[model samples]
Target: MPPLRPELQAAHDEMDETGQDYAFAVCPTWQGDAWEVNTKEVNIYSALSGTFKSHAEATAAGTAWLLGV
Candidate 1:
């Protein structure tokens, strides 16, 4: 996978219930007004839709969805 931005730290490096390894990170949108939660499972990468006002919010939401918490 490509490297994350210098200002951004890596997040979510745990396996889900099905034992699939995954990771997620909060990236700035193209417009730079909000954050998008980007996830990686196996070799596929995707971004979840949502408007997060801050990086922490995006990270929390992504973690919940990824872990099914």
Candidate 2:
């Protein structure tokens, strides 16, 4: 993975800390020598959407979207 800019990293980190109501779904997949940041809304790990506000939020959203509700 490439290095993220300091500002970008700060924004993301801030979002993470206070963004508990935010969705952050990350599916780590090993393709060969690197891990791919798979889709957050859909994929094998599509179990995350909007559940916990963070990962929970994502999961809830995923389930809901999957159910078409």
Q: Where is model 1 poorest over a 10-residue stretch in terms of lDDT?
A: 9-18
Best candidate, lDDT-wise?
Answer: 1
lDDT of 1 at 48: 79
Candidate lDDT values, in order: 0.68, 0.36
Model 1 C-alpha RMSD to native:
5.3
Model 1 misplacement above 4 A: 1-20
Angstrom error at residue 60, model 2: 26
TM-score top scorer: 1
lDDT of 2 by residue, 7-46 (tens): 3444345445543443233322222222222122211222
lDDT of 1 by residue, 1-69 (tens): 897554243333322333565767677776789887877787666677776999889989888878972
